[model samples]
Target: MTIHPPDRRDFARSVPVRLWDESFAADPLRHYQALRNQGPVGWGELAPGVPAYVVTDRRAALDVLHDEETFSHDPRAWEATVPDDSPVLGMMRWRPNALFADGAAHVRYRTTLIDVFDLVEPHDLRGRVHRAVRLLVGRIGPRGEADLVGDFAEPLMALVFNDLFGLPESQGDRLHSGVGKMMEGGDRATVGEAEYAQYVLDLIAAKTERRGDDLPSRLLDHPAGLTREEVTWQVFLTLGAGYGPTANLLSNTLSRILGNPLYYSTLTDGARPVMDAVVEVLHHETPLANYGIYYVRRPVAFHGVWLREAVPVVVSYGALGILAEREATERRHPNDASHLSWGAGAHACPVKQHTLLLVTEAIERLTQWLPDLDPVVPRDRLTWRPGPFHRSLTALPVRFSPRSPASEPSGVRS
Candidate 1:
C-alpha cells in the first residue's frame, strides 16, 4: 500500500484542518472527508497551534498502530513543545501508566491492570452494572422525559466505576463532571483535570490507609510492587479511560437504536440483538473517535509523508470508520467486529469485554423497564460535544411512559 508523496508545491499550499471547531464537532465526517482529500496522511490542528499528522486511510493507520518501534507512545518530546496551559495537555501529557509507556514499562503496567481487572468475574461485573442501571432508571423513570447522556449513560458509568474503584457512590458526580470536562478539552479543561486528579489522589490516600476488595487496593498489593504514586496514576488512567468512552458508547448505541423504528421494534421483539446496534455504532460513529496518539523520535518517511520528529501522529479512527463503510462488502457482516474503535496492536484496549458487558446490560435493563421510550430529537439533529479527541453527545433527550419507583420490579428502586 504505497502512496506517492505530494509535491512540495501541494505541501506548501496546504492548510492544516482545524479539528476543535464547532463545525467539526457538528459534522465530523465532512472534516474527515476534507482530510482524506489531502492525502493518506493529512495535517490537522488538535487545538490552536497544535499541529499533528492525522492518518485518514485505513492501511496507513494500521501501519502506524502496528509499528511500535517506529512510532512511540511516550509523548514527552511532543509535550515539551506544547504549552503548559494547552487544553490538550490534560490528555496528551506523559503519565507513568501504560498509555504513555513503552517496552518493559508498558508490559509491566499493562500486566498489573489486566491482572487486577481479571479478578472481577463476568457475573459480578454484570451485577454491578445491573444495580447501577436500576438506580439510574429509578431516578429518571418517574420523570418520563430525560436526557440519556446526563440522566442515564454518564451517571451510570460513574456509579459502576466508582464502586469498582472503591470510591463512595456520592462522588459519582465529581467523577462524571471532572472527566467530561477534561476530555472536552476547552476553557474548563484545567479545572476539570485538577478536580479529577484530586479525586484520584483522595482515593489512593484512603485506600492506602485502609485497603478494600477493589481495583485500587488490589493494584496497591500486587506482586509487581508498584509505588503509591504509580498506583495513583494507574487508577487515574483506568477510571478516566473507562468512564468517558463507555458513557459515549452507551449514549451512541441508544441514539442509534431509538432513532430507527424498525430497528427498535426488532430489538424489543428479540429479532435483532442489541450487540448488532452497538457494532453498527462502533463501525460508523465510535466514541473516542480520534485519540490514537503516537510520536516518532526522528523524521521519517511514512507512506509517502515525511513525519516531523516529536510531532503527534494521530490515527483518525473516525476517518477510518468512513473508509470501512465505503469499502464494506456483503461478505463483511454488519455485526463484524473488525472496526479499529478499540484500536490495534500493542496499545489496543484491554477492557473491551467489561465495557461491552456493562453497556449491553445497562441498555437491556433500561429498555426492559421503559419499553416505550422514544427519542425527542432525530439522531442527526442531536448536538455533539466539541473536542478534538472524543465524539460525544452534549445531550440525548428521550421520552417514555412515566412510572412510579414503587411500581417497578422489587430490585429496581434505589
Candidate 2:
C-alpha cells in the first residue's frame, strides 16, 4: 500500500509569511520541520500530484539517495513531464560522459577519472585557490563592499577546476563559459548541444594532437578509454555538475554568515575553522536542492511511500529530509553531521573529496586574504540569481582590507 502525507501547500499556508517565503529561494530547511509534521510522505509538487516526502529525517534521505535499485538517479524519471529535447535531457541521457551510465559502466567511467578527483587534496590546492581568492579579493578590497559571488566564488571555481583538471590556459575560459551556460538552463539552448558538441569534438581533436600528460589527454590514453565524443560528454558532465554548485556554495556561505551573526564566531572558532562553516552552509542549503525523477523504476517504499515507477520523485540534496548533527559543530568532524548535500549511494558524487578540497581552499584563502572580509552591497539590497537545479546567488557585493600581492586580470571583477 502507498502511504502519503497531507497537502504541503495547505500546511505551508499556515506557516508564517517570512518562513514560508524563505522556503522558496533560500534555506528551506526551516520548513523541513513543518513538512515532517504532516508525515514523511507529503503531498505537493514542483508539478501536479507529485507526491513526495518533504524528507527532514537524516536516516531517510541516506536510504533514498543511497539506494539505486528502488530509486534511479538517471534524471530520466520525469520523461513524462519535461520535453524530450530539454537541457535536463542532457543530464538524463547517457550522453558524451559517464554519469548517465549505471552499474559496471558507471564503475568504469568513475574509476578512469578517480585519480583526478582523488589527488586534488585540498592542501595541495591551498596555494592555488589562495592566489585566485587573493587576487579577486584585491579587486574589491579597495571598494570595501562587493559581491562574494562574482569576486570570490566564480573565480575560485575557474581556478580550482582549471588547476585540478589541468586545462590549458587558452581553452579554459571558453570551457568555463560553456559549462556556466549549461548550468543556467537547458543544454539545448545554452550549450547549443550540437554546436558545443562539434566544438568539443574539435577541442578533443586538437588536444589529442598534442597528447600531453594533461587530464584530458591522460584520460584518452587510459584503457577502456572513451572516444572523442565520449571525452567531450564527460567534459560536459564536469562543467554541468561542478561549476555552479561551487559558486552557489560560496555565495550561500557568505549569505549565511552575513545574516546569522552566530555563524561568524561559531563556525570560524575551530582548528579547521572554515571547514565546519563551509560544510554547515552546504548542509543547511544544498546548492543542488533536489534530484528530479519521473519514475520510481520499481515498487520501492521510501519515507513510507511505495512509489510506483514513472512517478516524479524529487530526491532533494538531503537538506530537507537529512539532519545536521550537533557534533558537526567541530571541524572535520562528521560524527554528528547528518547532512546530505551530496547525493548518496552508487550515484553519490564521485568527485566528493575533490569538490570539498576546492571549497576548503577557497574558504581558507578568504580568511587569510581578507580576515575582515565583509560584503559591501547592503545585505537586503543584494539580489540572487535563480537556477532550477542549483541554487545560486547572481551577485555578492563585499569589501575587505589588508590586501594580498596577487595581481588581477584586466577588466577583472571582484
Candidate 3:
C-alpha cells in the first residue's frame, strides 16, 4: 500500500462531479452506481481545494474504518491546508467530544457515554417513546393534514430526549432552536453553536448541584471522572447524535412506508411488519448517507487510492446500500444486519438498538392512530436537505382523516 503525493492538477482541475451536489442529493442511487462503476475509490471536491476521497466499495470502506492507526477521527492529525473559515469546519474540526477523538481519549469519552446510555433501560425508553408519540399524535390528530417530519418526528424525538435529560420545556425549546440553526449552517451557525454550548453547560451545572436519574447526572457520576467541559460536550454529542438522526430515520422510513407499494401493502395487509420496513429503509435509504470522516494518520494507500496524511476519507454508506440492493436478490438473508449505516469499527454508533426501537415505536403508534395516512404530494415532488452527511427531507407532508379532539384516549396527557 504505497501512498503517492496528491496530484496538483487534482486540486487545480475542474471537478465535473461533486457528491454533495443537488443532482446527487436528488437521485443518489444513480450517482452512487455511477461512482461504483467508475472505480473502487473516487476523488471529489467537498469545497474548492478541499478534496475528499470517497470509498464506494464496501470492502475498501471497511478497511478505512477499521484501520484506526492509519486513519484517525481526530482533526489534529490532519495536515491539510484548509482555511480557518472553511464552512465545513464546524463538522470536520476537532472537538473534545468522542466524535472527534482517537486512541486513549476516544476510549475514555466513548466509555463514559456508553455507561451513561446503559443507565437508560430499553423498556423505559420504549415507554417514553410511546407516551411521546401518543401526545404528539393527539395534538396533530385533529388536523387532517400534517408534516410528519416537522409536526411529528422531530418534536417526538425532542420530547423523548427532553425527558431523558430531565430538561424543562423552556430549556428544551432553546436546545431545539439552537440545534436547528446549527444544522442549517451559515454565518449565524456560530451563534447557535455558542447558544447550544451555554445551554449544555447550564444543564450540566444543574445536574451536578442537584443530581437526578437523568443521563446527565449518570454521566457526572460515571467512573471515567470526566471534566465539566467533557460532560457538557458528551451531553451535546449524545442528544445531538440521538435525536436528529433518529428523527431523520423515522422521516425517511415513514416516507417509504407510505410510498413504496410493497411496504404499504405490508402495513395494510400485515404481511411485513413495520420493523421489517425499517430494516428495508436502513438498507436502501440510510438517514446518515455519507460520514465517518477519518483523517489519514500517515501516508498510505489501500485499494489503489492514494491517501495522504491529513486528508479526509469518507465511508459512502448510501453507496454501500445501493451495492447491497444490487445484490439483495442473491443474498441468503436479504435483511442481514451487516449494513454500514450505523458505521463500523470502534467509532460505530453505540445507541443503534435504542434508535431502532425509537423508530419502531414511533411508526407503530403513528400508524395505529392514523392508519389511512397518505402523502400530500407525490414522492418525486419531495426535496432533500443539501448537505454532505445526512439524507434528510426538509419536510414530510401527509394527509389523513381528521380526528375529533374528543377522540383523545383517556389519561393520554399532551
C-alpha local distance difference test of each model = 0.87, 0.56, 0.76
- Give the range where candidate 2 is weakest over 10 consecutive residues by summed lDDT: 12-21
**By TM-score, how accurate is candidate 3?**
0.90
Clashes of 3: 0
How many steric clashes between backbone atoms does each model show?
Answer: 0, 28, 0
lDDT of 1 by residue, 69-171 (tens): 7889999989889889999999889989999999999999999999999999998998898888777777887889999999999999999999999988899
Candidate 1 — which residues are off by over 4 angstroms? Answer: 1-13, 409-414
Q: Whose TM-score is greatest here?
A: 1
- Candidate 2 regions off by >4 Å? 1-23, 26-38, 43-56, 75-81, 85-87, 90-93, 119-123, 168-177, 184-202, 258-272, 292-295, 299-303, 321-335, 377-383, 402-414
Each candidate's TM vs. the true structure?
0.95, 0.75, 0.90
Better of 2 and 3 by TM-score: 3
Candidate 1 clash figure, as a count? 0
lDDT of 2 by residue, 317-391 (tens): 534524454223456455234556665677667777767767766765565455565655665665544333456
**Candidate 3 lDDT by residue in tens digits, 82-173:** 87665456556677889998889999999988878887888898899888877777788888899998899888888999889988645656
TM-score of 1: 0.95
